[model samples]
Target: MWTTGKVIERIDWNEKLFSLRIKTDVEPFIAGQFIKLSQMRDDKRVARAYSLVNPPGCDYVEVLAVAVEDGQLSPDLKALNPGDSIEVTPKAAGFMTLDEVPKGALQGKHLWFFATGTAVGPFISMLATDEPWQRFEKVVLVYGVRLGEDLAYLDTIKQFIEQHPQQFVFIPIVTREDYPEGLSCRIPDGISSGLIEQKAGLGINAEHSQVMICGNPGMITDAQTALVEKGLVKNLRRAPGQITVEKYW
Candidate 1:
């Protein structure tokens, strides 16, 4: 299940975060799924899993990555240039997919999407498809990062707003930087303090909507607990609940 792809495009957002678009005849994958990519480091082959940034139906596959200080994989991954070839796993897999979201949840209510940092990848993937906008009457996507500059996918949000026009809302939260346009607190605070619900004008409830959370383990854990206090249960295969979550590290 290995394929070779060329780096068709590359973007350096900042010193820490970067973006890559790979050109390959990759198989179609569900939004919210991830691909395994391998690169050579210290003469040893190392593989890591990265959530695909492109939505379904796209010809090219995109990925967002954060560089580590002298990370074994980062040096090679970051050095990718146009026409550079890399190894990619043929199959993509993950459970944070929207397909797992119960049909009953999106029939006519709002769907809450929460993520921090690069965890936003899966949500972007989900939004690229027609299922969310077609089914849910309204959608709320909340993305959290440390600084305003760290926020990615402004173009994606712009495209969504232009296409849907108020059908969906994106809230960017920065804990350290306070831009008047973005919230300056953690996402859980936004939920508990009633800011997220108030801004969206829809209070989250088990009967009316469902929640999906993705981010670092700390954020996911804290958000899950907070949402539970608000009457949302963590969704499971056997015992379905109101919230579905994926941890980014």
Candidate 2:
């Protein structure tokens, strides 16, 4: 059912990217789950699923989104200011949480998160919690965007690095322009070329890596193909494997 949500805060990352922190009655949810935001438009309901960026125990829900050109709802969302009301799902939903990863023997030592664009939101939510730090020896985040200006949440990421210097790695990839702190290739190309692993100083294989990829469909497909070539398999509930993915679009 739909619940009324008030926009309590907003953060403009760039002209196109922004974050909305909403106060609502949405039930507690897992870190990586998503909630649908909706509005009534000309007698029709326009809704979109956005992954919750805030960690699970928060009193509010936060989502990172980009205003897609000519999108049905995002442009309107972009125009919203604090105190504006929107409709939200009362309960968040999705199966991309860390709980899905296998435990004990199959649970690898390194947890890798691959994200592009606003898909990094869910990963950020997961990282804010203690589960990953307690469970894995190493955690890595590979975030890719179109340009340097498109990267978001740098300060939060920096905090993670400071808190876990030896155990965390962040690889930024900017494809269209120079990003001295990151790579110039697309995510799949980086993996295929070994540049990503070279930066992490750790190789991905079936035994030691648990990878969760969330991003544009094209990136997810190509990245998964590259990982599969490296012996990692798709993670499924029935048959646990190494790679897990959520396509943002």
Candidate 3:
């Protein structure tokens, strides 16, 4: 079912990237899930799934999105201003949350998040919760984008660092341009080349690392392959393993 949501706030990170905070009633959701936004055109419904950026229990829901060229619904979403009304899913859905990660002895010492473009939204939601901090010894977020300007939620990330300076690590990756603080290669390459682990000052293995990957499918595929080479396996409900993934597009 759909619910009417009013845009309460909007943040434009760049020409193509933006965030919408909407006021609406949605079923309680866990972090790392997504909700669908919709619009009707010529009696046809146009809808897309957007990962929630805000954590659970918030009065309003937030979503980070990019205006894809010639996209069916994203452009319309990009044009929305505060007070604009939109359609939202009453229930959020997805299985990429930390809940899917193994618990007890299987839970690794370090939690790594690999995201690209707007896919970083879900990871941000997960980080906002207390589960990651309380469950692992180290939490690292590796965010990749075309340019430094595309890196959204830096302020919130900074706050996380301030609060857990010793436990949190943020790594930025800018592929198309120069970013002094980030790597200039794709995520898979970084992993295969050992640059990612080197920068984290921690190696990834089956025993010590649990990786959650989101964003571009290309990155997900290749990054998963690299992790597998390092002895990590795909996480499943019946047979839990180290790596969990969700493809954004």
- lDDT (10s digit) by residue, model 1, range 1-249: 788988999988887788889987777789999997788767888888889989988888888888888776766788888999989887788999878887763333778899998889888888989989987878888989998888888898879878887688888888896778778879988888888887777888888778999999988888888898898887887877779998887
Q: Mind giving the per-residue lDDT tens digits that candidate 3 earns over 1-249?
A: 999999999999999999999999999999999999999989999999999999999999999999988999999999999999999999999998988999999998999999999999999999999999999999999999999999999999999999999999999999999999989989999999999999989999999999999998899999999999999999999999999999997
Count of clashes in candidate 2? 0
Candidate 2 TM-score to native: 0.99
Judged by whole-model lDDT over C-alpha atoms, candidate 2 comes out at 0.95
Could you tell which candidate, 1 or 3, scores higher by TM-score? 3
Q: Report the Cα lDDT for residue 44, model 2.
A: 100
Q: How accurate locally is residue 100 in candidate 2, as Cα lDDT from 0 to 100?
A: 94
Where is model 2 more than 4 Å wrong at Cα?
Answer: none
What stretches of model 1 exceed 4 Å from their correct place? 105-108
How far residue 2's Cα lies from its native spot in candidate 2, in Å, is 0.5
lDDT of predicted model 1: 0.85
What are the per-model C-alpha RMSD values against the true structure?
1.4, 0.7, 0.6
